[model samples]
Target chain A: MSNLIKLNGHTASVAEDEWLLVSLPASEAEERKQAGKVVLFKLTGENTVTNKQIANTVIPTTGKVIVPLSVFIARKAVLQARISKGEIGVWLSTHEVLEHLIKSQPDLNGLPMMAIHVERFADGRIFSLGTLLRTRYGYQNELRAFGDVLRDQLYFLKRSGFTSFQIRADRSAEDALASLNDFSVPYQGAVDEPQPVFQRYNRAV
Target chain B: MYKYDEIDQTIVDERVAQYRDQTRRFLAGELTEDEFRPLRLQNGLYIQRYAPMLRIAVPYGMLSSKQLHKLGDIASKYDKGYGHFSTRQNLQLNWPTVEDSPDILAELATVEMHAIQTSGNCIRNITTDQFAGVAPDEIIDPRAIAEILRQWSTFHPEFALLPRKFKIAVSGTKHDRAVVQAHDIGMEFYTDAQGKMAIRVWVGGGLGRTPILGSVIREHLEWQHALTYCEAIIRVYNLHGRRDNIYKARVKILVKALGIDEFKKQVEAEWAHLKGAPNTITETELTRVSQHFETMPYETLPRHDAGFDTTLVSNPAFAAWVKRCVHPHKMAGYRAVTLSLKPHGKAPGDASSKQMWAVADLAEQYSFAELRVSHEQNLILADVKLADLFALWEKARANGLATPNIGLLTDIICCPGGDFCSLANAKSIPIAEAIQMQFDNLDYLHDIGDIEINISGCMNGCGHHSVGHIGILGVDKDSSEWYQVSIGGKQGNDASLGTVIGPSFAAEEMPRVIQKLIDVYIAERMPEEHFIDTVRRLGIAPFKANVYTKEGAAA
Candidate 1:
């Protein structure tokens, strides 16, 4: 089980096996794991990290570390090149991962990716980031973001880009599972690809 | 006096609504301070030392009397009843709360004005000679070109986000009073033999950490291609200019980094792609903009004023006022009178509500209801007749506007330094006041003659300290305020940057330092040489030695 803490308002989660990690894309996580440095990132609780910790330079680029968002804006080219080569590991925030691909694609050919929801707080930028990444940038990967992610945001986030989530350890898995049935239809284009909104209906038929 | 057409009106109204929304979001906490910082800056709102300062663009230093009255009303209602005219030909209100800005902007919009792109990392208000259309030597009104750029660049999709702020100045007069050499892009308006006016464009001149004079890139570009050329330059700069270091982000640095030739080539390539496109200006649009000023009725009268003679004979003070405050007009009977806001010891460009009303009244009564704010920190009634000179001077003197120090040593161009500005190193207003008190003697100043003592609070050069005949820059050393003095900088016609004289001086010691330099000029000058001409003749070595010498041999 992971513990979550709100940091700079973004819900951040920490796992016992991890030294310190903010859920980022494959590239960011790869960079961190490769760096293998003891990382300290801001979070709402003991386990979760927010988008604010996306590019923070708490420790030098020794090995696994969390970076700040500003770092990505500055070193997009270099970071993109590294990500393309698959030499680094990254944890993508719910939405940030998609913007990167849409804005800059160093290796769009076939790159494995994953997403994380930092917290269950009131802030929704990460969810928007997720939806935009999936719907706008067309990222089809394991999307997980649900701390306090209400059924609506979860459904939207799922339809948009996210596909997987870590629910509250205390809550019943059945109740949590039951809330996921709030939405009837996937509206239109999503993280998967540019397909018709009624493609799910087509699948059902 | 470029009137707003449908497009111009549309852009301004759209900008006002945009700023209103930004303000609402900022007030409602929907936008964070970091997110709203650039948005407010794009609307020309600065959180200054005391309060929020709103800088309203007075495009090319031109304002209609109605516009001036609107500024006065905004200052009175929303602010502390006064406005400071900035060196950029803009008006700044220093005491407005965050909430009041939306209303103030909305008010400004009614007059076809909004503070868009004035303080942001985008193209700033395109400034031209204050005497643009009225100046005798102008080929055509540079305001024509300025208005074209105004329309084309306002909320320009691509240029809205640039690496750094860009400033373009145009000079139509032979004498470059517009400080063309110190702008990011300086264009001189000239006519070819076939009588078609064109722009002689120079790029990459600025004064901040690294002061540079622009090198000419395009000698003769047609007026229609002016906006496109400017867009090309800005686009190239936006993509290539450095963002890592704030100091290196200005286009001047980019020009320096790339070298002028390569920069010009890049700009030429960019220009090639952009020119003759959909954005090319139309002659009909130019005609529409030019119509705003084309039809001012002029009554041909004799050159001399008999009343001016009688007043000169009767009042020596009036004659002295004429000598200093008045200038020869392009029209025979008319004279351009400067309403000096810099009294014996006051802030350089500040005018109270009363003073503003007085100038408005005088403009209406004497000068065709038009006024000009000169780059020299004074207001000009550009078309006043010589016959009404005495009445105007008397009215101005009564209102404390007739300082009789136009272009003299005391007519110092100063910026609001540490007292108000957030980016100042030390207080510049006090420094100017101190110098003004030291040089109170009119005859002494007249003897010194035609000297520009410009002071900047910091290195931003808002005070135009670089081009002053005697420039003073405020620097802090060990917590004490000190000034760096420079000699021999001139702006008009032949522009040269001033050379610093050795070490800096304590704030109190600056006046003596200036006196010493003047003493050297007085001793070395041939018959009737001014400070700058003497510096030209004798070189800076003598002035440097005399200024920095242990003993001036006389004190």
Candidate 2:
């Protein structure tokens, strides 16, 4: 069945059956039926829930630990030693690191989810980030981006990840939906999902 | 001088218009300060310690008398009647108003000059040996290659967004007067075993927080692949160079993180993709560029002018100048005359507007309407006729450019440190003045012959302190000013960074330290040896011991 995709308030194809809508909050995850809340499950900066949070409370051992981009090998080793052995998720800021991660971990797709942050929509670093996910890392799961997201950037984001985005309240649902028709062809490639432009051209022969 | 053709003229004119629009937007408040900062800097406009400084490009340190006159006119009209010649071979007018910059650039463009990339984190003005075409020992005229690279890299789309500013220097002679070792990329043309010109490329060499001698990655790259190879290296560097930390953003850090061999392999991989692209150098383009610098028809005269000899013999001061300022030339009659700006107690490499006008007139009268700014903080008339030597010397003496102190103790290569540059840690001009005052005699300077006393306000090496024979570095010690002295360094082909003698000296103790070092050199020299040659033979131990001895300590 088709689902209602409310991205920054406008409705488009939810693609819930074909593409997953990965999010971060537990409450947001409960509200949506098909969408999954893959909260950054790792300790970062001064904030973020740690292993101690789950140690005192009763959480499932099947959960994954989502690590920050700046997390190092030493912290990873400590985190693995402290928590029970489970699937690990790594969130990165740039495509170069994503390439390194994919090269190091050949079976990264088997993990539940991997998310990347586009810190600011004004910054073009996300273009490289998206390019890496699709071209280099070949990540199949939801490539979520937060912070300063807008409707205009969503088109490129969709081509790269085929996932949903979180945008600011000032951007209306009408403008967000209008931007989806800005380009017909995929400017970039996505993993496990061939863009309509690419598929039509390739199968025409 | 290389005259601008239709394409060059169009680009410059379009750039001028673009800058005028940017300036208008900035003045009208459409662009905020944060947004306008990089825009202004990219146009060679700097909000300086006092006022906005306009830096104009002196492409490859080559300028015609007409260009110098135009620069003087710009300085006089828009600035405070002066321009400073920078170590990177550009000229900066320190007091130009923000409104006057577009007019200044328009004025410069009239003479086929533009300030593009003079201050931005882009490919800066390409520099080469001042004696590129005139040096007797030069194997090829590096100006041809310098101009080619300058044209290719100007406004290049792919490599423009580098992590940091990139500097490239070309040297035809093995002597390396261009200081190619201290640049981001250094290219030198050398004849291979087959007697064909091959380019030797050096990468990751820069003098800053970490001064590194670039490693030679490609020994005998064909001349046709110069641009493509350089573009490949920059492409790989731009895409991979670290940008998280500004300090760790240079290609040096990348080369350090990945070994030079690995960097070379990556560059080769990139070059393999770009080998036949539009960026590749074509023989037609090379010849077109080379035609601009082909040697002018020179009239050969006597090797030595009897008039110059008579004047030298008659006037002791003129004799001293002739002995120091004149250099041997490969041409039968031409001689390279060095106009030392390092007067007894003046700023190094600073020619006031008046001095600039004087040099322009002298170049027109004596030389072939050409002048060169050497990396050694001196101006050179590269093609002076032998017959005009005496007349030029007399006129130069009147304007104070004929300081007969070339290569002497007073010939100091200094940078405008804390006084001008915001990044400088210590004031360097006063230190240079102090040393110049202490050693004012031509006779004494002649005694302390051929010693390079380079001073920099900081470790950035703008003054080339690392390559000085007697290098002086200003350091802050316990909130007080101090200088660190180094010995046995050399700049040319035998380039080596100076080794520090010992602990740093107080600012007051520097002159005494220099005296003691010179004393050691005089006492230990093995007959007729130059300062660098003697230092190499006796090593820095004897000089270091003398300079830092407890008994030789300052009272």
Which candidate has the highest lDDT of all? Answer: 2
* Cα lDDT of model 2 by residue, B90-178, tens digit: 88787888998888888898999999888766678899988888788888787767877887666553443466778999998868888
In angstroms, give how far residue A138 of model 2 lies from its true place. Answer: 17
Can you tell me the DockQ of model 1?
0.03
Using all chains and alpha carbons, the TM-scores for the candidates as numbered come to 0.75, 0.77
Clashes of 1: 55
lDDT by residue for model 2 (A52-100), tens: 3323332223445555533422244555542334355556653234534
- List runs of model 1 lying over 4 Å from the truth: A1-205, B551-555
Q: List the lowest-lDDT window of 10 residues for candidate 1 chain B.
A: B152-161
Candidate 1 displacement at residue B143 in angstroms: 0.9
lDDT of 1 by residue, B280-319 (tens): 6667656656767673576798977787788799898888
The C-alpha RMSD in Å for every predicted model, in order, reads 11.9, 10.3
